[model samples]
Target: MKRTMLAVAGALLLGACATPSTEVGIALFNDTVQPLMVTGNTGTKVGRACAKNYLGLVITGDMSVEAAKKDGKITQVASVNKEVKGYALYAEVCTVVTGR
Candidate 1:
């Protein structure tokens, strides 16, 4: 009975200490968008950018839309995409800007 009580207490402690995480993992979708042309046979390009999340509260780093566009050498954006990869206590929010 004592062992069972200890186990239950341990479980409760661990559960209480656990941090809530949201939107963890890769997401191949856009959070924002603009009107742009995506044509076939055109040269495809991709730009990547990342932002860091601290303690699930503070966010630091650069994941600018313009930066992604520049990285892909895109004058006129065809489409914008995003990817989010994260783990316990930290996260990396990334953006993939695609263009022709």
Candidate 2:
């Protein structure tokens, strides 16, 4: 019974600590995935290129890449907008991604 109670409490604590993605990740996700999600890119290359650019942005942020990766902050990669250019998002994303 004690063990079960501890497990439940632990799960609840961890769940409560969950936070939203950083501004940079959110922006990148929106820009890169938005176009593809809305109309489906004409070619795979276009879609891949978009993703690559966004990823590049994340890698060049002010934070250390290792820290961001460690914090699981990059998971927002899939939650982007469905109809946006994402270049501005990319520049900011780069700083966050790299910096983190």
User: What is the per-residue lDDT of model 1 for residues 6-68, given as tens digits with 9 covering 90 to 100?
Assistant: 988765544332333334423222133333335443447887677876455677768887888
How far out, in Å, is residue 11 in model 1? 14
Top candidate, metric TM-score: 1
Most lDDT-accurate candidate: 1
TM-score of 1: 0.54
- Please provide, for model 2 over 57-80, each residue's C-alpha lDDT reduced to its tens digit, 9 standing for 90 to 100: 233223333344344444223312
**Model 1 residue pairs with clashes:** none
TM-score of each: 0.54, 0.23
lDDT of each: 0.58, 0.32
Superposed by TM-score, candidate 2 places the C-alpha of residue 67 at a distance from the truth, in angstroms, of 18
